[model samples]
Target chain A: MSRTEAHPEPPALAPGEVRTRWIVSTPPILFLSLFFLAPFLIVLLASFQYPGEFGGLAPLLAQGDSPDHGLTWENYQFFFSDTLFAEIFLKSFLVAALSTLLCLVMAYPVAWLIARSPKGRRDLLVLLVILPFASNFLIRVYAWMIILGPQQALAQGVNWVLSALGQEPVNLLFSPFAVLVGMVYVHLPFMILPLATNLEKHDPLWLDAARDLGATSWQRFWRVTWPLSLPGVFAGSALVFIPVLGMFAIPDILGGTRDMLIGNLIKDQFLGVRDWPFGATLSILLTLAVLGLAGLATWAGKPRRGHD
Target chain B: MTRPSPWLLLAAGLVYAFLYLPLAIVVAYSFNDSRLNAEWVGFTLDWYRTLFNDGEMLLAARNSLLIAFTASLSATVLGTLAGMAMHRYRFRFLPFLVITPVAMPEILLGVSLLVFFLQALHLTLGMVSVILAHITFSIGFVAIVVRVRLHGLDEKIFEAARDLGATPWQTFRWVTFPLILPAMAAGMLMAFALSLDDFVITFFTAGVGVSTLPLQIYSMIKIAVTPEVNAVSTLLMLLTLVLVIAASRLDKTFMKGAA
Candidate 1:
């Protein structure tokens, strides 16, 4: 037997355990507290601050002519009163939901195939799925510009085929459809990876058991495979959905400037209009929404200790 | 296992094609001698030559490498520490705090940072801001990877080392570090790739005068598409391919060792 196997088990409360744990955690805790937590706190505080007349933050405690004087809901009030903010928020959610749905549809089949493929070929297929992500994201989205453009080879070929069939050429680019395509294309791998990981854990015996119990293939899948894979499905969906909500470049590039999402609005607030406080408020709200969704997913996915 | 279905294979093949065809077209057009992004005339290496010769593209590439290297390295270090903490210790709010970045949208993070930097901090948009922002997101990924690795580890080894009079730091360096090195490497590589590919966050935080390859590509696309950009992209893709292969190989080796 190896030395490791020969050794007796150690007690849980070993000496130096507390110190070691503290040492292990301190660096990351320090880094995150300073960089991630602090900056976010700053933004959260900025969000609550009132906006100056010139669109800057006034001092919170001091009453002044500046916009950032004590606590006020003026920025959020502005967001609520404006129809554009609501429209943009709803549109962003729709885009994210549709994108997540599309990714689920697209990724499931690909992941299933990958999981079932011969071991020799599986790695290569997985590699292909991951390869596109390595390229510049904006450039890959730009590639669609060529594919979906009027003179794009695919479009031209389609146009030719349509003319032969007595149909008119279609303008498919620069639409919500195009944005959905881009989002799915970009995020499919995120969906696939988590799904594949979960699916790979599933034993074939479960299916065999179902079959032996006189279940049809569809029934076996719906009862066994689907339930088993819910964790991954939720995870992958959240992964794709959350990012799609914040997506700016995909819609901006593919759907064009006309289809502005909330991300674009936030960007416009900061850079275009130079409204930092309002932008901060939008960001905080969006962050809260994401946190809420994530919390829901976790609650749903949490395993019952005794049941499993 | 069931027999392989032909329909399933065909569907997978079509999806792969859909995913790759646009990219393949860009690569093919990079070699075309045509001035227009569309309508390939013939194959030529001129675009690559132009890409290499263009000072702005080269500078952008250099900046991208610099930012990715620095940000990813820092994220790896911090993430490893965080992962070790989560794995070794049970703390209240640990999971919640660790998962916050994962759940938060990149856009909100980006804009928030942009707002903080511009308004509150009064920091200029430059390499420092970009690196800080990249590290913020990349560290979470690295921590997750390392956390997985740590979960699979045997605790007895560390206990034995400590019993043998090794200090906590020594126990980690001699016992824990080597075991988790593969995950560290994977996390670092992922961090680098993410930093290199980051557009949205970088776009917001990267104030005036600082440009990485993705930022450069974004600006260039806003104006027009060029074969030179495609060539640069092809090169970036190849580089990413190499790094991913290396990281995956390391990961497989580590998995094998663990198994």
Candidate 2:
């Protein structure tokens, strides 16, 4: 009757047994440490170094103006003083949050429908949802350029329709709205997949039970479905929000020179301004902020395993 | 369960149309005889011929393939090892370290790698640098997938193998590897697609002369949007579609196995 009865027993490790697990793991650990970890440490170190007049690493240590070696908060000071940094950071958060909210609003209904669909149509629906993600991201984003361009068929068509309606042509491209559209389009699947998976795993008996107990539809959703699906919502939001926050390509390609996000600022510091220290500082701060937000989300969405 | 809602169906259809319409237009325009992306002059295979005949595009395609193949292979191996270690061991900081790359944005990773190469390492950007950067991000993805598959694996199989006089390596090769192979394959394919499509990291890490497909497309789009680019995009999209279908098939098979 039990699932365990279907399989044969297997032996356990002897008492006090210790295997050489580190040998298999050390290579990857060392690789990540040297390449991934060390680079970030170097960036962190460089953040303290002064920026030269030519926007290179300054010889703060050589000047002997500061204690120990080259060190200065001038780059951070500059970034703080420049209101543009705060504006860009705030804009980045706003875009990511709005995109996340949009994805949740749109994806939940779709995911719920897919989860409740008949067996025959479920696979087809799932495939439809996932197929777009398989395509090259850059190509897909660029496809938006063709769709949103002034001379684009869709744009022109919309313009003609507006003209027929005695209204002005809509300018949807190269604006914050365009950026949001692209971001949500690109990230919608990330929100849907986790939500659908979790919803599919959820039992309908609980909802039926609630309905049978004289609960309204809203009460059933609030009492049974919503609490159970919180984990999925948390996961989907994190998946969508984090990448949207760090998105550089969507805003760059769609918003053009008019818009700037934290990603663009970081990129500009490194390439255009050649201020590696400042860029590294910005990147580290952004990474920490993301990590903090993710932690907060997970804590807030923690499932009460034993309560139910 | 409730019957199908017409409103829900309508919303789903509209969303699908919105998602696929742009891609459909690109594919349709690829066959247009016009050089510009705006007007579809007439249907012809001229753009595809142009895509094939262009030496630079061909070279870029080859480079993209080379980079994706090499990076995905190395990432799969390294990621499998890392995933297994995390699943089986109690090493402190293992979880944090493995998922760090996922949190960091690709642009930052690309820029940091560029800085590290130019400033600290004194290495010029080239194929090797691109591959290194690709591996850096791809490893996290592969690790996550493999770890998920490993989580569903029964520990008893490995214990049985070990008890039957099999070495650790043998146990892993015969039992663990086979069990997680589907996830590993899916991960590798996804990594390949990601590496091939990568623009930002490759853009930064590629040396002055080297050009990948995405890099070529980026530069070309900057100057002008051409039908040949559309042709190339169509091909890339088809290729990715095939890979995704294959991955999903493998996913189904793995799920069946688990069931």
Candidate 3:
């Protein structure tokens, strides 16, 4: 069952095996280094440089050794000097956290149901959760736009209730509520799958023991099941929270004019404002933020999962 | 297992409805006689007819197919190598290179590649750039699928092949290759599907005048709310559904890797 035993390393190395290892490993290592690793490094380098006269990054080595030859700390300083950028970062975290919370709330019951289902039906139930997600991402968001459009039944019903309550009618399509709904809808299955996998591993005998001791149903859940499921919750939250931070399409399609997140800001820099250095700066910051959060999640969940 | 309580059943049913109602409405409204998606009108095939006749849309479809084909083909070969290397060797850096793309925020990949292509390589953004970008992210998925397949295989078979005087290449050709063929097929299909359905990455890399199906759909939806968009979406959904289901059938582990 151990990894080494299952695929044992040879005690002695063969000449052909060494050659084969180098040959097999070289292509992907080279390809990823060039296309994947090199690009991020370039982004970091570009962050220190100036924006080109036309658009993209200014040439790193222009004319002479002049100070204006496309290098400065202006991008990072700009990000720090303005509180607006920090506020947007905070807003993105807030949105991502809220979406993760909503996904957990919606997914828990479904996951629990699947976990407690007959063994033969678990795969079918899990597949049912994943089926909607298999459709194109844009199509999922577009579906919500239709449902939340002004003339749609849901919007009309909400407006009628608002009128009866002496409040103004609200447009549902281009709003924060629409963005959150789209996010939760898109990410709910991620929460469900991990949670179901975890919950399915629980021993029914634990619950039976608690029940035999005259424990109430509520006590059994609160004192036993809920506490046992925290690891799954953390795993699912990380899955939902990280992606929601970088999402732009949902906000672009479903949000109001004022609903821009870090993603839209980074996007606008390159595509709209034509500031490559600033965009690269924001991207590097986001990467750092993601890595920090991922590290924190690992540190926090380390004891619960009992290993690295 | 205990039966689900009635409240649990109701909550789960609502979630299921939340998932499916939007897609059902889209398909139904695609067939509506009217242009508006707000209400269901009479049935008609006008939208499908319109989609077929739209020359620009057809061009985008062609581009998407071409990109998916080329990207998935190359990714499958590279990914199989990466997977085998990870399984058979103890390289520290290879796992990082192979897995980071699959794990990182996709927009980061998209923007970084945009910078790399435009600023470093100074290559004009076009079909070739888009295909390269697709291959970059897709190698990870295919690697994961191949790795999972290899894990389920018995190591004894390869040892037996080697003991019988088969060389490493011969062992791979006669033993490992046949065993992992289904997983490779599943990986390739998954890659093809990912490439075809990609939007955020393609959005940054496609540049001006180059369009894929998702890019084309995005522009159309932004400009208008027509049944034509819904028709195309339903068709795209059906196509992806078939591809994913087929991949799952070829390898059950595809479900795990994909999720």
Native contacts, share recovered per candidate: 0.67, 0.48, 0.73
Query: Quick one: best TM-score, which candidate?
Result: 3
Model 2 ranges with Cα > 4 A deviation = A1-19, A52-56, A63-69, A157-170, A213-224, A304-308, B207-209, B253-259
lDDT of 2 by residue, B1-259 (tens): 7664687778867777877887898899999988777877889999899889999999999999999999999999998888887777656676566777766577767877887887678887898999998998888778877877876677677777877988777877788888899899988887888799888888778968589999898877767788888899999999988887887687653322111
Q: Which digits, one per residue and each the tens of the lDDT, describe model 3 over residues B1-259?
A: 5678999999999999999999998899999999888777798999999999999999999999999999999999999999998888878788889988887788889999999998889899999899999999999999989988899888889888888999889989999999999999999999999999999999999899589999999998788879998999999989988998899899989888776
Candidate RMSDs in Å, in order, are 3.9, 4.0, 1.8
lDDT of each: 0.80, 0.80, 0.90
Pairs of residues at least 3 apart in sequence or in different chains that clash in candidate 2: none
Model 1, range A1-308, lDDT digits (tens) per residue?
A: 12223334444745676677777788777766766687788888887776556655666776644434677777889889989898899999999999898888888888888777778787777778887866778877988877888877767888899999999987667878788888888888888877877777777888899999999978987888787788888888888888888888888888966788878888887778877778888888888788888887777776556424
Tens-digit per-residue lDDT, B123-203, candidate 1: 888999999889988887888788777766777677779779998778888888899998999889888988998998899
Model 2 reaches what TM-score against the true structure?
0.90
Winner on DockQ (1 vs 3): 3
Give me the overall lDDT of model 3: 0.90
Better of 2 and 3 by TM-score: 3
Model 1, global lDDT: 0.80
Considering only chain B, what TM-score does candidate 3 achieve? 0.98
Task: Quote the lDDT for B91 in model 2.
Answer: 66
Could you list the iRMS of every candidate?
4.5, 4.3, 1.6
Please provide, for model 3 over A1-308, each residue's C-alpha lDDT reduced to its tens digit, 9 standing for 90 to 100.
13535777678768888999898999998999999999999999989998887888777787556445667999999999999999999999999999999999999999999999986788889888888898889999999999999999899999999999999999999999999999999999989998888789888888899999999999988888877877788778888998899999999999998899999999999899989899999999999988888877776654354321
